[model samples]
Target: MRWQKQPVHYPYEHVVCYDLETITDQEMQDGSFPPWPRHRPVAGSFLTAEWSPVGYRFKLDTLLCREGREAEFYRKVDSLLPPGGMGVSLNGRNFDNAVLRLQAQRNGLFDLRNIARQAESSRFDVAHLDLLDVFGARPGTSLAELCRALSIPVKTSVTGGDVADLWRSGNVAAVKAYVQEDVIATYILHLHAAAWREGHERQLVLPLADLAIWLEGEPGLRHLLSFATCRPARWARSRAPALRAAAALAEAELRLKREQDEAAFSAR
Candidate 1:
Protein backbone atom coordinates (compact mmCIF):
# COMPACT_ATOMS: atom_id res chain seq x y z
CA MET A 1 0.00 0.00 0.00
CA ARG A 2 1.20 3.49 -0.84
CA TRP A 3 1.80 5.66 2.22
CA GLN A 4 0.11 9.06 2.29
CA LYS A 5 2.76 11.69 2.91
CA GLN A 6 0.45 14.69 3.12
CA PRO A 7 -1.66 15.41 6.18
CA VAL A 8 -5.41 14.72 6.05
CA HIS A 9 -7.77 17.62 6.61
CA TYR A 10 -9.55 18.16 9.97
CA PRO A 11 -8.54 16.88 13.44
CA TYR A 12 -6.43 13.94 12.24
CA GLU A 13 -3.47 16.03 11.23
CA HIS A 14 -2.17 16.32 14.78
CA VAL A 15 -1.95 12.78 16.20
CA VAL A 16 -2.70 9.06 16.47
CA CYS A 17 -3.99 7.43 19.68
CA TYR A 18 -3.42 3.92 21.04
CA ASP A 19 -3.91 1.82 24.22
CA LEU A 20 -2.39 -1.45 25.46
CA GLU A 21 -3.11 -4.21 27.99
CA THR A 22 -0.33 -6.44 29.24
CA ILE A 23 0.08 -9.47 31.55
CA THR A 24 2.62 -8.74 34.24
CA ASP A 25 4.31 -11.23 36.55
CA GLN A 26 2.57 -9.61 39.44
CA GLU A 27 -0.80 -10.38 37.94
CA MET A 28 0.01 -13.99 37.16
CA GLN A 29 1.49 -14.87 40.55
CA ASP A 30 -1.18 -12.98 42.45
CA GLY A 31 -4.13 -14.56 40.62
CA SER A 32 -5.01 -11.45 38.55
CA PHE A 33 -4.88 -9.04 41.47
CA PRO A 34 -2.51 -6.06 41.42
CA PRO A 35 1.02 -7.32 40.82
CA TRP A 36 3.99 -6.45 42.96
CA PRO A 37 6.90 -5.01 41.00
CA ARG A 38 9.65 -7.03 42.67
CA HIS A 39 8.61 -10.22 40.93
CA ARG A 40 9.62 -8.87 37.49
CA PRO A 41 7.27 -11.32 35.83
CA VAL A 42 6.18 -11.44 32.20
CA ALA A 43 2.92 -10.11 30.81
CA GLY A 44 1.01 -10.12 27.50
CA SER A 45 -2.11 -8.60 26.03
CA PHE A 46 -4.16 -7.58 23.00
CA LEU A 47 -3.56 -3.94 22.07
CA THR A 48 -5.62 -1.51 19.98
CA ALA A 49 -5.26 2.03 18.68
CA GLU A 50 -6.99 4.76 16.70
CA TRP A 51 -5.26 6.71 13.99
CA SER A 52 -6.64 10.09 13.14
CA PRO A 53 -8.92 9.97 10.06
CA VAL A 54 -8.70 6.20 10.15
CA GLY A 55 -10.86 5.94 13.30
CA TYR A 56 -10.67 3.28 16.07
CA ARG A 57 -9.17 -0.10 15.11
CA PHE A 58 -8.41 -2.94 17.47
CA LYS A 59 -5.34 -5.14 17.18
CA LEU A 60 -4.37 -8.13 19.27
CA ASP A 61 -0.92 -7.16 20.50
CA THR A 62 1.25 -8.09 23.46
CA LEU A 63 3.90 -6.90 25.90
CA LEU A 64 6.48 -8.63 28.19
CA CYS A 65 7.17 -12.28 27.51
CA ARG A 66 9.80 -14.98 27.87
CA GLU A 67 9.53 -15.38 24.11
CA GLY A 68 10.92 -13.00 21.53
CA ARG A 69 7.67 -11.42 20.39
CA GLU A 70 8.50 -7.79 21.11
CA ALA A 71 10.59 -7.43 17.94
CA GLU A 72 7.74 -8.75 15.88
CA PHE A 73 5.30 -6.43 17.65
CA TYR A 74 7.51 -3.41 16.99
CA ARG A 75 7.97 -4.38 13.37
CA LYS A 76 4.22 -4.62 12.89
CA VAL A 77 3.61 -1.36 14.75
CA ASP A 78 6.31 0.48 12.82
CA SER A 79 4.93 -0.69 9.50
CA LEU A 80 1.43 0.65 10.24
CA LEU A 81 2.71 3.91 11.68
CA PRO A 82 3.94 6.76 9.48
CA PRO A 83 7.60 7.55 10.05
CA GLY A 84 6.93 11.02 11.46
CA GLY A 85 3.39 10.79 12.74
CA MET A 86 2.70 12.28 16.13
CA GLY A 87 1.89 9.62 18.76
CA VAL A 88 -0.77 10.72 21.21
CA SER A 89 -1.10 8.65 24.38
CA LEU A 90 -2.72 9.16 27.77
CA ASN A 91 0.72 8.87 29.42
CA GLY A 92 2.44 6.74 26.84
CA ARG A 93 5.92 8.14 26.88
CA ASN A 94 6.55 7.31 30.52
CA PHE A 95 4.58 4.09 30.73
CA ASP A 96 3.65 2.49 27.40
CA ASN A 97 6.79 3.10 25.33
CA ALA A 98 9.07 2.59 28.28
CA VAL A 99 7.48 -0.75 29.16
CA LEU A 100 7.53 -1.87 25.52
CA ARG A 101 11.19 -0.98 25.15
CA LEU A 102 12.06 -2.72 28.40
CA GLN A 103 10.18 -5.83 27.40
CA ALA A 104 11.91 -5.82 24.02
CA GLN A 105 15.29 -5.63 25.67
CA ARG A 106 14.42 -8.25 28.30
CA ASN A 107 13.23 -10.61 25.60
CA GLY A 108 16.44 -9.92 23.65
CA LEU A 109 14.43 -8.53 20.73
CA PHE A 110 16.24 -5.23 20.50
CA ASP A 111 19.60 -5.00 18.79
CA LEU A 112 21.73 -2.44 20.58
CA ARG A 113 23.59 -1.52 17.40
CA ASN A 114 20.39 -0.94 15.45
CA ILE A 115 18.92 1.02 18.34
CA ALA A 116 21.97 3.25 18.39
CA ARG A 117 21.70 3.80 14.67
CA GLN A 118 18.00 4.61 14.90
CA ALA A 119 18.74 7.10 17.64
CA GLU A 120 21.74 8.63 15.85
CA SER A 121 20.15 8.81 12.42
CA SER A 122 16.93 10.21 13.84
CA ARG A 123 15.01 7.93 11.50
CA PHE A 124 12.51 7.31 14.27
CA ASP A 125 11.76 10.94 14.95
CA VAL A 126 8.08 10.60 15.65
CA ALA A 127 6.96 13.12 18.24
CA HIS A 128 4.96 11.88 21.21
CA LEU A 129 2.04 14.12 22.21
CA ASP A 130 0.93 12.87 25.61
CA LEU A 131 -2.61 13.78 26.68
CA LEU A 132 -1.64 13.31 30.33
CA ASP A 133 1.16 15.79 29.85
CA VAL A 134 -1.17 18.25 28.23
CA PHE A 135 -3.71 17.79 30.98
CA GLY A 136 -1.12 17.53 33.73
CA ALA A 137 -0.59 21.25 33.47
CA ARG A 138 -4.10 21.48 34.88
CA PRO A 139 -4.43 20.00 38.36
CA GLY A 140 -6.48 16.85 39.13
CA THR A 141 -6.45 15.45 35.58
CA SER A 142 -6.18 11.69 34.92
CA LEU A 143 -7.28 9.32 32.18
CA ALA A 144 -10.69 8.76 33.79
CA GLU A 145 -10.79 12.30 35.10
CA LEU A 146 -9.96 13.76 31.71
CA CYS A 147 -12.65 11.65 30.05
CA ARG A 148 -15.14 12.95 32.58
CA ALA A 149 -14.04 16.56 32.06
CA LEU A 150 -14.48 16.19 28.32
CA SER A 151 -17.91 14.50 28.66
CA ILE A 152 -16.64 11.14 27.41
CA PRO A 153 -17.77 7.92 29.03
CA VAL A 154 -15.19 5.57 30.57
CA LYS A 155 -15.16 2.20 28.78
CA THR A 156 -13.19 -0.16 30.97
CA SER A 157 -15.11 -2.68 33.10
CA VAL A 158 -12.29 -3.31 35.60
CA THR A 159 -9.03 -1.79 36.73
CA GLY A 160 -5.57 -3.10 35.79
CA GLY A 161 -5.31 -4.85 39.15
CA ASP A 162 -8.28 -7.02 38.27
CA VAL A 163 -6.96 -8.19 34.87
CA ALA A 164 -4.67 -10.86 36.33
CA ASP A 165 -7.51 -12.38 38.31
CA LEU A 166 -9.82 -12.18 35.32
CA TRP A 167 -7.26 -13.95 33.19
CA ARG A 168 -6.16 -16.46 35.82
CA SER A 169 -9.76 -17.33 36.60
CA GLY A 170 -10.37 -18.25 32.94
CA ASN A 171 -12.47 -15.26 31.98
CA VAL A 172 -10.77 -14.79 28.62
CA ALA A 173 -13.95 -13.49 27.07
CA ALA A 174 -14.40 -10.94 29.83
CA VAL A 175 -10.78 -9.84 29.62
CA LYS A 176 -11.05 -9.38 25.89
CA ALA A 177 -14.31 -7.50 26.24
CA TYR A 178 -12.87 -5.25 28.93
CA VAL A 179 -9.74 -4.46 26.93
CA GLN A 180 -11.80 -3.68 23.86
CA GLU A 181 -13.86 -1.23 25.88
CA ASP A 182 -10.66 0.50 27.00
CA VAL A 183 -9.58 0.81 23.38
CA ILE A 184 -12.89 2.47 22.53
CA ALA A 185 -12.64 4.87 25.44
CA THR A 186 -9.07 5.76 24.52
CA TYR A 187 -10.09 6.39 20.92
CA ILE A 188 -12.95 8.65 21.96
CA LEU A 189 -10.70 10.68 24.24
CA HIS A 190 -8.26 11.17 21.40
CA LEU A 191 -10.98 12.38 19.07
CA HIS A 192 -12.49 14.60 21.71
CA ALA A 193 -9.19 16.27 22.44
CA ALA A 194 -8.35 16.62 18.78
CA ALA A 195 -11.72 18.19 18.10
CA TRP A 196 -11.30 20.52 21.02
CA ARG A 197 -7.95 21.60 19.65
CA GLU A 198 -9.52 22.26 16.24
CA GLY A 199 -12.37 24.29 17.79
CA HIS A 200 -15.13 21.85 16.78
CA GLU A 201 -17.46 21.18 19.69
CA ARG A 202 -19.97 19.11 17.71
CA GLN A 203 -17.39 16.52 16.65
CA LEU A 204 -16.55 15.76 20.26
CA VAL A 205 -19.11 13.00 20.58
CA LEU A 206 -18.31 9.73 18.74
CA PRO A 207 -20.91 6.97 18.57
CA LEU A 208 -19.76 3.34 19.08
CA ALA A 209 -20.87 2.23 15.63
CA ASP A 210 -19.11 5.12 13.97
CA LEU A 211 -15.99 4.30 15.97
CA ALA A 212 -16.08 0.65 14.86
CA ILE A 213 -16.52 1.68 11.23
CA TRP A 214 -13.64 4.09 11.53
CA LEU A 215 -11.44 1.27 12.94
CA GLU A 216 -12.32 -0.93 9.99
CA GLY A 217 -10.29 1.35 7.73
CA GLU A 218 -7.14 1.56 9.85
CA PRO A 219 -3.92 0.18 8.27
CA GLY A 220 -2.55 -0.98 11.67
CA LEU A 221 -4.79 -3.97 12.43
CA ARG A 222 -3.50 -6.07 9.56
CA HIS A 223 0.10 -5.45 10.59
CA LEU A 224 -0.52 -6.53 14.20
CA LEU A 225 -2.44 -9.69 13.31
CA SER A 226 0.13 -10.70 10.77
CA PHE A 227 2.83 -10.38 13.40
CA ALA A 228 0.91 -12.51 15.89
CA THR A 229 0.25 -15.16 13.28
CA CYS A 230 3.96 -15.46 12.48
CA ARG A 231 5.07 -16.24 16.04
CA PRO A 232 5.97 -19.77 17.15
CA ALA A 233 3.42 -21.96 18.87
CA ARG A 234 5.59 -22.07 21.99
CA TRP A 235 5.01 -18.40 22.73
CA ALA A 236 1.26 -18.81 22.49
CA ARG A 237 1.40 -21.99 24.54
CA SER A 238 3.08 -20.27 27.48
CA ARG A 239 0.10 -17.99 27.93
CA ALA A 240 -2.32 -20.92 27.68
CA PRO A 241 -1.24 -22.53 30.98
CA ALA A 242 -1.68 -19.34 32.98
CA LEU A 243 -4.97 -18.59 31.29
CA ARG A 244 -6.18 -22.09 32.11
CA ALA A 245 -5.22 -21.66 35.73
CA ALA A 246 -7.10 -18.39 35.79
CA ALA A 247 -10.17 -20.07 34.34
CA ALA A 248 -10.09 -22.82 36.94
CA LEU A 249 -9.86 -20.27 39.74
CA ALA A 250 -12.72 -18.27 38.31
CA GLU A 251 -14.90 -21.38 38.19
CA ALA A 252 -14.19 -22.30 41.79
CA GLU A 253 -14.92 -18.75 42.91
CA LEU A 254 -18.17 -18.76 40.99
CA ARG A 255 -19.20 -22.03 42.56
CA LEU A 256 -18.47 -20.77 46.04
CA LYS A 257 -20.43 -17.60 45.43
CA ARG A 258 -23.38 -19.60 44.12
CA GLU A 259 -23.35 -21.88 47.20
CA GLN A 260 -23.22 -18.89 49.49
CA ASP A 261 -26.18 -17.27 47.76
CA GLU A 262 -28.14 -20.51 47.91
CA ALA A 263 -27.46 -20.96 51.62
CA ALA A 264 -28.52 -17.37 52.31
CA PHE A 265 -31.77 -17.90 50.40
CA SER A 266 -32.49 -21.15 52.33
CA ALA A 267 -31.85 -19.39 55.66
CA ARG A 268 -34.31 -16.69 54.74
Candidate 2:
Protein backbone atom coordinates (compact mmCIF):
# COMPACT_ATOMS: atom_id res chain seq x y z
CA MET A 1 0.00 0.00 0.00
CA ARG A 2 1.10 3.57 -0.57
CA TRP A 3 2.21 5.66 2.40
CA GLN A 4 -0.58 7.60 4.07
CA LYS A 5 0.09 11.27 4.77
CA GLN A 6 -1.88 10.90 7.96
CA PRO A 7 -3.44 8.09 9.95
CA VAL A 8 -6.75 6.66 8.80
CA HIS A 9 -9.02 8.90 10.81
CA TYR A 10 -12.34 10.76 10.48
CA PRO A 11 -15.39 8.98 11.86
CA TYR A 12 -18.25 9.88 9.57
CA GLU A 13 -20.95 7.23 9.32
CA HIS A 14 -22.49 8.14 5.99
CA VAL A 15 -20.28 8.40 2.89
CA VAL A 16 -20.70 9.21 -0.78
CA CYS A 17 -17.87 8.02 -3.01
CA TYR A 18 -17.83 9.80 -6.33
CA ASP A 19 -15.97 10.21 -9.66
CA LEU A 20 -16.35 12.56 -12.56
CA GLU A 21 -16.00 12.18 -16.34
CA THR A 22 -15.14 15.33 -18.20
CA ILE A 23 -14.49 16.69 -21.71
CA THR A 24 -12.17 19.53 -22.64
CA ASP A 25 -13.39 22.66 -24.40
CA GLN A 26 -12.82 22.75 -28.15
CA GLU A 27 -11.41 26.28 -28.11
CA MET A 28 -9.13 26.12 -25.11
CA GLN A 29 -5.46 25.21 -25.35
CA ASP A 30 -4.04 22.33 -23.38
CA GLY A 31 -2.26 22.60 -19.98
CA SER A 32 -4.82 24.45 -17.91
CA PHE A 33 -4.63 25.15 -14.20
CA PRO A 34 -7.41 23.49 -12.26
CA PRO A 35 -7.48 21.13 -15.23
CA TRP A 36 -10.88 19.66 -14.43
CA PRO A 37 -12.60 23.06 -14.30
CA ARG A 38 -11.40 23.89 -17.81
CA HIS A 39 -13.11 20.73 -18.94
CA ARG A 40 -16.84 20.17 -18.57
CA PRO A 41 -18.39 17.29 -16.70
CA VAL A 42 -20.26 15.00 -19.07
CA ALA A 43 -21.12 12.41 -16.48
CA GLY A 44 -20.49 11.38 -12.89
CA SER A 45 -21.24 8.49 -10.55
CA PHE A 46 -21.64 8.24 -6.78
CA LEU A 47 -21.93 5.29 -4.43
CA THR A 48 -23.84 6.08 -1.25
CA ALA A 49 -23.15 3.85 1.71
CA GLU A 50 -24.18 4.23 5.33
CA TRP A 51 -22.56 2.28 8.13
CA SER A 52 -24.68 -0.10 10.16
CA PRO A 53 -23.96 -2.48 12.99
CA VAL A 54 -23.75 -5.26 10.48
CA GLY A 55 -21.80 -3.35 7.84
CA TYR A 56 -22.14 -0.61 5.27
CA ARG A 57 -25.00 -0.85 2.75
CA PHE A 58 -24.28 0.49 -0.71
CA LYS A 59 -26.62 2.02 -3.31
CA LEU A 60 -25.16 2.92 -6.69
CA ASP A 61 -26.33 5.37 -9.34
CA THR A 62 -25.02 7.58 -12.11
CA LEU A 63 -25.73 11.08 -13.43
CA LEU A 64 -25.55 12.05 -17.12
CA CYS A 65 -25.20 15.60 -18.33
CA ARG A 66 -25.74 16.54 -21.94
CA GLU A 67 -23.41 19.16 -23.43
CA GLY A 68 -24.71 22.34 -21.81
CA ARG A 69 -26.47 20.82 -18.79
CA GLU A 70 -23.46 20.86 -16.47
CA ALA A 71 -25.17 22.92 -13.80
CA GLU A 72 -28.03 20.45 -13.61
CA PHE A 73 -25.54 17.66 -12.93
CA TYR A 74 -24.07 19.60 -10.02
CA ARG A 75 -27.57 20.31 -8.69
CA LYS A 76 -28.55 16.66 -8.93
CA VAL A 77 -25.41 15.63 -7.07
CA ASP A 78 -26.10 18.19 -4.34
CA SER A 79 -29.70 17.02 -4.03
CA LEU A 80 -28.78 13.34 -3.84
CA LEU A 81 -26.17 13.52 -1.08
CA PRO A 82 -27.31 13.55 2.54
CA PRO A 83 -26.74 16.63 4.65
CA GLY A 84 -23.22 16.60 6.16
CA GLY A 85 -22.37 13.16 4.78
CA MET A 86 -18.68 12.55 4.17
CA GLY A 87 -17.45 12.58 0.57
CA VAL A 88 -14.79 10.17 -0.70
CA SER A 89 -12.83 10.35 -3.91
CA LEU A 90 -9.50 9.14 -5.23
CA ASN A 91 -7.88 12.56 -5.89
CA GLY A 92 -10.91 14.58 -4.94
CA ARG A 93 -9.17 17.26 -2.92
CA ASN A 94 -7.11 18.39 -5.88
CA PHE A 95 -9.03 17.18 -8.93
CA ASP A 96 -12.70 16.42 -8.34
CA ASN A 97 -13.51 19.04 -5.71
CA ALA A 98 -11.32 21.55 -7.49
CA VAL A 99 -13.39 21.09 -10.63
CA LEU A 100 -16.62 21.34 -8.69
CA ARG A 101 -15.52 24.50 -6.90
CA LEU A 102 -14.30 26.25 -10.04
CA GLN A 103 -17.32 25.33 -12.15
CA ALA A 104 -19.69 26.12 -9.31
CA GLN A 105 -18.17 29.55 -9.00
CA ARG A 106 -18.59 30.14 -12.70
CA ASN A 107 -22.26 29.15 -12.55
CA GLY A 108 -22.99 31.02 -9.33
CA LEU A 109 -23.66 27.74 -7.50
CA PHE A 110 -22.80 28.83 -3.98
CA ASP A 111 -24.43 25.80 -2.39
CA LEU A 112 -22.45 23.41 -4.57
CA ARG A 113 -19.30 25.40 -3.86
CA ASN A 114 -19.89 25.14 -0.13
CA ILE A 115 -20.41 21.40 -0.40
CA ALA A 116 -17.24 21.08 -2.45
CA ARG A 117 -15.31 23.23 0.02
CA GLN A 118 -16.39 21.12 2.94
CA ALA A 119 -15.40 18.01 1.07
CA GLU A 120 -12.03 19.44 -0.03
CA SER A 121 -10.87 20.86 3.29
CA SER A 122 -8.98 19.05 6.04
CA ARG A 123 -10.12 21.39 8.79
CA PHE A 124 -11.62 20.36 12.10
CA ASP A 125 -15.13 20.38 10.60
CA VAL A 126 -14.21 18.84 7.25
CA ALA A 127 -16.69 16.36 5.77
CA HIS A 128 -14.63 15.06 2.87
CA LEU A 129 -11.97 12.37 2.75
CA ASP A 130 -9.62 12.13 -0.20
CA LEU A 131 -8.11 8.67 -0.32
CA LEU A 132 -5.33 9.84 -2.62
CA ASP A 133 -4.43 12.51 -0.11
CA VAL A 134 -4.69 10.01 2.71
CA PHE A 135 -2.31 7.70 0.87
CA GLY A 136 0.13 10.58 0.52
CA ALA A 137 1.21 12.33 -2.68
CA ARG A 138 3.80 10.37 -4.57
CA PRO A 139 4.59 9.15 -8.05
CA GLY A 140 2.93 5.84 -9.02
CA THR A 141 0.17 6.20 -6.40
CA SER A 142 -2.87 6.60 -8.62
CA LEU A 143 -6.13 4.83 -7.77
CA ALA A 144 -5.26 1.83 -9.95
CA GLU A 145 -1.86 1.60 -8.37
CA LEU A 146 -3.20 1.79 -4.83
CA CYS A 147 -5.87 -0.78 -5.62
CA ARG A 148 -3.22 -3.12 -6.91
CA ALA A 149 -1.15 -2.69 -3.75
CA LEU A 150 -4.18 -3.40 -1.58
CA SER A 151 -5.31 -6.39 -3.68
CA ILE A 152 -8.53 -4.81 -4.89
CA PRO A 153 -9.84 -5.70 -8.35
CA VAL A 154 -10.30 -2.55 -10.37
CA LYS A 155 -11.77 -2.28 -13.87
CA THR A 156 -9.14 -2.52 -16.59
CA SER A 157 -11.43 -2.09 -19.57
CA VAL A 158 -10.70 1.64 -19.91
CA THR A 159 -8.43 4.35 -18.57
CA GLY A 160 -9.25 7.89 -17.47
CA GLY A 161 -7.39 9.37 -20.39
CA ASP A 162 -9.78 7.61 -22.75
CA VAL A 163 -12.96 8.96 -21.18
CA ALA A 164 -13.21 12.24 -23.09
CA ASP A 165 -12.68 10.57 -26.45
CA LEU A 166 -15.03 7.74 -25.60
CA TRP A 167 -17.79 10.12 -24.57
CA ARG A 168 -17.30 12.20 -27.69
CA SER A 169 -17.60 9.06 -29.79
CA GLY A 170 -21.00 8.40 -28.17
CA ASN A 171 -19.88 5.65 -25.83
CA VAL A 172 -21.56 7.07 -22.78
CA ALA A 173 -22.14 3.64 -21.25
CA ALA A 174 -18.42 2.97 -21.15
CA VAL A 175 -17.77 6.31 -19.48
CA LYS A 176 -20.45 5.60 -16.90
CA ALA A 177 -19.02 2.16 -16.28
CA TYR A 178 -15.53 3.55 -15.80
CA VAL A 179 -16.76 6.20 -13.39
CA GLN A 180 -18.76 3.62 -11.43
CA GLU A 181 -15.72 1.39 -11.11
CA ASP A 182 -13.60 4.25 -9.82
CA VAL A 183 -16.21 5.26 -7.23
CA ILE A 184 -16.82 1.70 -6.06
CA ALA A 185 -13.12 1.07 -5.76
CA THR A 186 -12.80 4.26 -3.74
CA TYR A 187 -15.61 3.12 -1.41
CA ILE A 188 -13.96 -0.24 -0.89
CA LEU A 189 -10.74 1.53 0.02
CA HIS A 190 -12.72 3.79 2.32
CA LEU A 191 -14.13 0.76 4.12
CA HIS A 192 -10.66 -0.68 4.54
CA ALA A 193 -9.41 2.66 5.83
CA ALA A 194 -12.26 2.78 8.32
CA ALA A 195 -11.46 -0.72 9.43
CA TRP A 196 -7.85 0.30 9.86
CA ARG A 197 -8.83 3.37 11.85
CA GLU A 198 -11.23 1.50 14.13
CA GLY A 199 -8.83 -1.45 14.62
CA HIS A 200 -11.27 -4.00 13.26
CA GLU A 201 -9.79 -5.89 10.34
CA ARG A 202 -13.01 -7.89 10.01
CA GLN A 203 -14.79 -4.66 9.11
CA LEU A 204 -13.17 -4.75 5.68
CA VAL A 205 -14.69 -7.93 4.23
CA LEU A 206 -18.04 -7.63 6.01
CA PRO A 207 -19.02 -4.51 4.10
CA LEU A 208 -17.87 -6.13 0.86
CA ALA A 209 -19.99 -9.18 1.59
CA ASP A 210 -22.99 -7.02 2.39
CA LEU A 211 -22.50 -4.91 -0.70
CA ALA A 212 -22.20 -8.06 -2.81
CA ILE A 213 -25.49 -9.39 -1.47
CA TRP A 214 -27.12 -6.04 -2.10
CA LEU A 215 -25.76 -5.98 -5.66
CA GLU A 216 -27.21 -9.39 -6.44
CA GLY A 217 -30.66 -7.85 -6.84
CA GLU A 218 -29.46 -4.76 -8.64
CA PRO A 219 -29.27 -5.50 -12.37
CA GLY A 220 -27.68 -2.15 -13.09
CA LEU A 221 -24.72 -2.95 -10.86
CA ARG A 222 -24.08 -6.52 -11.95
CA HIS A 223 -20.84 -5.50 -13.56
CA LEU A 224 -19.43 -4.47 -10.21
CA LEU A 225 -20.47 -7.50 -8.17
CA SER A 226 -17.45 -9.68 -8.84
CA PHE A 227 -14.90 -6.87 -8.79
CA ALA A 228 -16.29 -5.39 -5.60
CA THR A 229 -16.62 -8.66 -3.70
CA CYS A 230 -13.24 -10.18 -4.36
CA ARG A 231 -11.87 -12.47 -1.58
CA PRO A 232 -15.00 -12.35 0.60
CA ALA A 233 -15.38 -16.15 0.61
CA ARG A 234 -13.16 -16.54 3.66
CA TRP A 235 -15.55 -14.36 5.62
CA ALA A 236 -18.64 -16.38 4.70
CA ARG A 237 -19.47 -17.60 8.21
CA SER A 238 -19.02 -14.21 9.78
CA ARG A 239 -21.15 -12.51 7.11
CA ALA A 240 -24.45 -14.04 8.13
CA PRO A 241 -25.82 -10.95 9.82
CA ALA A 242 -24.79 -8.67 6.98
CA LEU A 243 -26.34 -11.07 4.47
CA ARG A 244 -29.55 -11.05 6.49
CA ALA A 245 -29.60 -7.28 6.52
CA ALA A 246 -29.08 -7.19 2.76
CA ALA A 247 -31.91 -9.66 2.27
CA ALA A 248 -34.22 -7.49 4.35
CA LEU A 249 -33.29 -4.42 2.36
CA ALA A 250 -33.84 -6.23 -0.93
CA GLU A 251 -37.22 -7.49 0.20
CA ALA A 252 -38.28 -4.06 1.34
CA GLU A 253 -37.32 -2.59 -2.00
CA LEU A 254 -39.24 -5.24 -3.90
CA ARG A 255 -42.28 -4.71 -1.70
CA LEU A 256 -42.14 -0.99 -2.29
CA LYS A 257 -41.90 -1.56 -6.03
CA ARG A 258 -44.90 -3.87 -5.96
CA GLU A 259 -46.91 -1.34 -4.02
CA GLN A 260 -46.05 1.35 -6.49
CA ASP A 261 -46.99 -0.90 -9.38
CA GLU A 262 -50.30 -1.79 -7.78
CA ALA A 263 -51.08 1.86 -7.14
CA ALA A 264 -50.27 2.74 -10.73
CA PHE A 265 -52.43 -0.13 -12.06
CA SER A 266 -55.29 0.93 -9.79
CA ALA A 267 -55.14 4.44 -11.17
CA ARG A 268 -55.64 3.00 -14.65
Best by TM-score: 2
Which stretch of 10 consecutive residues in model 1 shows the poorest summed lDDT?
224-233
Top-scoring candidate (lDDT) = 2
Candidate 2, run of 10 with poorest lDDT: 27-36
Give each model's whole-structure lDDT.
Answer: 0.48, 0.72
Cα lDDT of model 2 by residue, 1-268, tens digit: 9986764446556777788877776534564333455677778888888888656677777999885776787788776555667777777776776776677677777776445654557733347777766666552468888787777777669987788789888999999988888887888787777676677655565666667677777888888766645654235326656656777899899999999999999999
Writing each residue's lDDT as its tens digit, candidate 1 over 1-268 gives: 9987864343344344555556655335544434222233234333334444333344444333234455666555444333444555565555555555555466576654322222232212345555665544442245677666644445435765566677667776665555545544565566555555657433333323334444446565332122222222223334444555665799899999999999999999
Model 2: clashing residue pairs? none
> Candidate 2's error at 191, in angstroms?
1.5
How many backbone clashes does every candidate have? 11, 0
